[model samples]
Target: MDFVLQIINGLHVGSIYALIALGYTMVYGIVKLINFAHGDVIMIGSYVVLLSLTELHVPFWIAIIVAVVFCALLGMLIERFAYKPLRNASRITPLITAIGVSLLLQNIAMKVFSANPKPFPNVISGEPFQFGGVQVGQVTIYTILISVVLMVLLELFVLKTKMGKAMRAVSEDAGAATLMGININTTIAITFAIGSGLAAVGGALYSTAYPIVDPYIGSMLGLKAFIAAVLGGIGKIQGAMLGAFIIGITECLTKGYVSSQLSEAVVFAILILVLLVKPAGILGQNIREKV
Candidate 1:
């Protein structure tokens, strides 16, 4: 029973990682940049929600909505102001700029929001919902459900919507997309906005479940999410979530039976081995370069 519960806990954590990973993967797919600031962006999201809830005394759901929107808009602005001008610069330039932006946001947040961790108000009331012999918290169930729903919505958007089609076109070949009359800049910004919105959802759920918010919170979680993205195959939408579940469950099982300290080491070791065996990842496809 404990083992099952552990897996559920892990699944919830993995779902958040997957959500954050989507932003990393999406931005990487279109721009070929890591967007190191993404994790900090999530940090900002949580702070926004926390402020809205505490200072303004907004309801939980409304606060979340406002936070997500704010983060998405901030993402668009970041792309426009920080990245757009340097789009044509060398790859290193943008990458460094992203790292700089990450540090900048973290420091600004620290100064503005303070370095102390704030507890998020728990809006849900109840015990774990039981199924057969296993027990899971309503929070866990809600996290998983919301993650799955958001992922499905994003998948539908990417594969079916007109904007999604344009995003896909840009990912395939920006030069060709430009020649085809696609608005490359708009598509890129839209991708960032979508990715950031998902991150905000993940951020809100994370703070709600764990009930702690801090400026530096996104660092470790973001790294884990990035790992999940690589593990499942970057640039593949379904792969991100798949990787998240795998990592989440594995971490839970390890922590349950094995030493908690070594669990992260073990998980990362598996990641290295997986990459060594399959560079493209589980669901990743290789693109051949023309000679």
Candidate 2:
């Protein structure tokens, strides 16, 4: 029963990771840029929710909506003004820009929200559910359910929608997509919007579970999610989800049975092993390039 409970806890955490990883995977698939600043978007989302709930006095759901919209617009703007200008530049240029953007966001957040960590509001209050001698928090249940639902919806959207087809086309060949009247810029912008919106949702769920928000929180969270994306196969959505669950479970079990301080090290070590064994990731396919 204890083991089962730990697995559940891990799943809850993994769900949030999966949400953030989706954003990373989607952006990388289309733009082939790591978007290191992606994690800061999660931090921005948390602040949006925090201010909305505390200052604006809005309902929890409304706060989430506001966060999603704000982050979506922010993502689009980042792509439009920052990334788009450097789209055709050398790859390393955009990579450095991404890191700079991340630092900029962190500093901006520090100035706006201060360096102190604020307590996240307990929007959902309830006792833990006991099942077969295992306890599960209400927040955990909500986090897992909502994350899974959103992922499924996103998968359906990407597989079945016209815009999704355009996204895939752009990913495959931007020049060809433009020649086909696909509006490459708009497609990439929409992709950023969706990915950012998912990050906002993930941010809200993360705050609920952790009950704290800080300016630097997104950096570590984003790093883990990026690792999850790489582990699951960067361009594959389902692979990202699978990798998140694996990472979440491993982290939880390690913390529970091993040293808490060693859990992160263990996770990174596993990533290294995986990379050494299969650089393309679990579900990633390696394509040979002609020299």
Candidate 3:
């Protein structure tokens, strides 16, 4: 029963990780650029929700929508102001710029929201439900259900919409996509928007679980989500979810059975082993270098 409980806990955490990982994977898929500022974006989302709830006295559902929309718009702004301008520059230049943006945003958030952690209102009842000898929380079920729904909607959008087709075209070959009349700039911005929106949901859900918000919170979770993305396959959406569950389960089991201090190390070691065995990752396709 304890083992089952641990697995349930892992799934709950994994669902949040997967939501954040989706953001990383989507951006990487379209642009081949890891937006380091994404972490700060999640941080911003948390603050947005907190402000909405506490300051504006908004309902939880409305606050969630507002937070996600705000993050999506912020993502669009970042792509327009920061990334788009540096498109023609060296790869390292953009990467460094991303890192700079990340630090800048975090510091700004610290100044605006303060360095201290603030508690979030309990959106979901914390009562646990028992199923097959496993105790699960309503919040956990909500997170998983929402994650699955969003993933499905994303898949449908990508596979069915004209804008999504243009995105795919640009992702496949930007130069060709531009020549074929696909709006590369628009597609890139939209990709960032979707990715950031997903990250907002993740931030909100995570805050519900921990009920605290701080500037540096995103740093650790962002790194872990990125690891999960890479572990499953950086460019694969489904792989990100799978990797998240694997990592979460491993960490939970380790902490429950082994030493808490060594849980992260053990999980990362396993990540390294998986990468060494299959560098492309479990669900990744073979990426050929451009000549």
Candidate 4:
């Protein structure tokens, strides 16, 4: 029963990781750039919801919507101002810029919200659902359901929508896609918008689960999501989801049966193993290029 409960707890955390990983994968696929600042979007989203709910007295759902919109716009802005200008420059330039942007946002957040950790409001409150000896919290169930629905929607959007087709084209070959009359810049911006918005959703869910907001909170969460993305396959959406569950379940099981202090070490160890065995990840394919 304890083991089963741990699995459930892992699923809850995994869902949040999946949400964040989706953003990472989508942005990478379209732009081929790892947005290090992507994680901080989660922090920004949490604060938006916090301020909305606490200051404006808005409902939790409304705050989530507000945060999603705000983050989406922020994502687009970041891409336009920070990334777009360096589109043709060396990859390292954008990479450094991304790190710089991350630091800039963290400092800005620290200046505004301060460096203290704040308690996030418990949006879902109720007794745990009991099934035989196992009990599941309302928050856990809600997180799982919402994350699944969002994942399904994103999959459908990418596979069935025109913009999604353009995104795929951009991912495969940007020059060819541009010759085919696709607006490369627009497609990339939209990808960032979607990814960042998903990060907001993850942030909102994470705040409910962990119930704390700190300036540096997104740093570790972002690393976890990045690892999940790499573990499942960085460029593959399905791979991201699968990796997230594996990571979440493993971390939870470690914490339950082993030391909580060692859980993170275990997670990092798994990543190292995966990299050694499958550099392209579980679902990733390796392509050979001739110079």
For residues 81-174, write the lDDT of model 4, one tens digit per residue. Answer: 9999999999899999999989988999999999999998878998999999788999999999999999999999999999989999999999
Model 3 local distance difference test score: 0.89
Per-candidate TM-scores read: 0.97, 0.97, 0.96, 0.98
Tell me the tens digit of each residue's lDDT in model 1 across 33-109: 88889998898888888889889998988888998999999999999989999999999998998898889999999
Model 2 CA RMSD to the hidden true structure, in angstroms: 1.1
**How accurate locally, in lDDT, is each candidate?**
0.89, 0.94, 0.89, 0.93
TM-score of 4: 0.98
Of 3 and 4, the candidate ahead on lDDT is: 4
Candidate 2 lDDT by residue in tens digits, 1-291: 778888998999899999999999999999999999999999999999999999999999999999999999999999988899999999999999999999999999999899999999999898988877778899999999999999999999998999999999998888899999998888999999999999999999999888899999899999999999999999889989998999999999998888899989988998999989989888888878859
Top lDDT prediction, candidate number? 2
Candidate 3 local lDDT, residue 58: 88
RMSD in angstroms, all models?
A: 1.1, 1.1, 1.3, 1.0
Question: In model 3, what are the clashing residue pairs, if there are any?
Answer: none
How does model 3 score by TM-score? Answer: 0.96
Clashing pairs in 1: none
Name every residue pair that clashes in candidate 2. none
How well is each residue in 177-219 modelled by candidate 3, as lDDT tens digits?
A: 9999998988999999999999898899889888999998899
